[model samples]
Target: MGEDCNLHEQACAAVLAPGVAVTLDISPKPVRAMTDLEFTVSLSDRNGPVDGAQVALDLSMPGMFMGENRSILSGLGNGLYQGKGVIPKCPSGKTLWRGDLQVQVGDVTGNVWFLFSVK
Candidate 1:
């Protein structure tokens, strides 16, 4: 598991290609479970912000099953996509969750994971 991202303090980013990168930003800060969250996903390249792509994110816990929590985002132009979703609180008191961001441009698809903790 890629447990390097801290989505509470800042946006976590991962590279797809040499100059292409994807970032996952969530708010309001100090993410908590069973609350509405605004998800902002961005894709950029050497030229600039890449737009007109289908973007979505699947929220899950590493090494555990937490049902299906997916957020399908709409393009807000300039490579930024926004969506709303909720993170369900775990019964086992698990704080760690993974935001599996999926980016699709044309027929090509890419994925990146952002690890975060819920209060």
Candidate 2:
């Protein structure tokens, strides 16, 4: 399946599964291409931080292939995960990119998508 299709599937699965709230914080807002991008993923459920969960980030531009830019995040206690990655410049000059944050804790899985522009 294409990346876009896969992303849609993940979003749907996340909705159908138990609610998993995700909060994202990207450093140096107004992210620019070919630059360092740091992000923090915070996972939480009904109880509290979903610690020890496997978290990963898939960064891509819709309809644009720039290879697979995936990063595995390190769990920082209290439901917080951190990772860094660089946004590649789009050959088509598209500045908008989609970030898919996938979280998996045992049998439960959740996904969150965010749109950001590259200067």
Candidate 3:
């Protein structure tokens, strides 16, 4: 597979199996800081554009009395996904607000955690 290949189906179908290639690029690897929170994720097959595949964004926030949970984000056109509402602001006190972010592409999902100052 190539950068433009669809890893979702390819991963499951075994067509590009046995560690074929890693497609999908989540820009801003570390996700240091984002204001607009507008990020670009590239998902394309060798043919170009996966088109109409289900993508989901799941968010988990720590330090919440309720505990971690899943938040659904909306999808933009062309392999771009946009999260709704304002992201959790900086936390307050000695502890900071921490949470995990998960991105799903078909049957495959990836995740990362983010921490911010306490508000």
Candidate 4:
């Protein structure tokens, strides 16, 4: 039973792809469901913030197939990208939400997922 529970938790957790280096900041922490949410994604490397990159956000709940809720983020100059979105209310009563930031800088592409709980 414990193993099964652990597996479920892991399945619901967010995952970051290897070799991806980026930071994400979500405004209005302690995200509330059915509310407006904003996010900032910063891509960087050894040199500095990565420029000329296309970024997007994919919001979903793990372990549930409710289609894809995605948003295209606009670059705010430098390596920072900003976008606005909303966390839909889960019909299954699950409060865990995952936000996957998809980044494409030149030939390199990667994703980082951030998980948060909704009240």
Candidate 5:
């Protein structure tokens, strides 16, 4: 839901469900293509950090075919999950990328779209 948001400068947040919220942060600011990148996803609600949730992120270039790149993140307690992935550099020199984040807790599932750019 953050197509106009610039995650390269700071963390961005989105609502995944009625009480579930998600925040995304990318390390090594000014994210670059064809490089290893770290993704941090935080899930929480009014009650505080959620725990034991499964999180997966899929990265792809919009309006372009870049193959399938998915990252499975490990739970790090307190609803914080971390994973590593890489985005291939587009031959057309485009830096815009989109992440499809899926969160599963018990039988409930939530999804969100995150728009970001790379160097």
Candidate 6:
């Protein structure tokens, strides 16, 4: 008797199916140098504000090592969010700076990278 009997493989294939993919969105692209930096995020294909989602912000300066950075936000009602943070400036060292923003909700994640100069 020469017959293939791999029923387990067939069962596994039947149960497994493709799932939805996660994507990131950030508003106010092409930021500029100013008093404060602000932006918004919309959950792609996800209903709701994605409560308790974690956001990471990093700042760097031209020709200099990265420095002080923080994250703060204000709830704008109905799943909308706004955040304000500080970026440190150094003279004779780093003037122009760039920022990196990372947002994570469950298994989904997003990122924003922007550049700005100090006045």
Q: Which candidate's lDDT is highest? A: 5
Instruction: Decide which is better by TM-score, 1 or 6.
Output: 1
Q: Number of clashing pairs, model 6?
A: 0
Global lDDT of each candidate: 0.88, 0.73, 0.36, 0.69, 0.89, 0.44
What would the per-residue lDDT of candidate 4 be over residues 5-64, giving only the tens digit for each residue? 222123222223344467666666656777887777777776766778888989888788
Segments of candidate 3 deviating more than 4 angstroms = 1-70, 86-95
- Report clash pairs, candidate 3: 4-44, 4-45, 5-45, 90-119, 91-117, 91-118, 91-119, 92-118, 92-119
lDDT measured at residue 110 in model 2 versus the true structure, 0 to 100: 71
In candidate 5, stretches whose alpha carbon ends up further than 4 angstroms from where it belongs are none
Instruction: Please give, for residues 21-103, the per-residue lDDT of candidate 5 as tens digits.
Output: 99988887888887889999999978999888899999998899899989998889988999999889888988888999999
Better by TM-score, candidate 5 or 2: 5
Off by over 4 Å in 2: 1-17
Q: Compare the candidates by TM-score and give the number of the best one.
A: 5
Q: Estimate each model's TM-score.
A: 0.92, 0.81, 0.40, 0.79, 0.94, 0.49
Clashing pairs for model 4 are none
Question: What is the C-alpha local distance difference test score of candidate 3?
Answer: 0.36
Q: Model 3, range 21-83, lDDT digits (tens) per residue?
A: 122222222222223333333344455544444434333345355233344445556644444
Cα deviation at 28, candidate 4, in Å, is 1.4
lDDT of 6 by residue, 4-102 (tens): 212112110110012312222223333333346554533333353345556555667746765566564444544444566555546564456655556
- How many backbone overlaps does candidate 1 show? 0
Distance from true position, residue 4, model 5, in Å?
4.1
Q: Tell me the lDDT of candidate 6.
A: 0.44
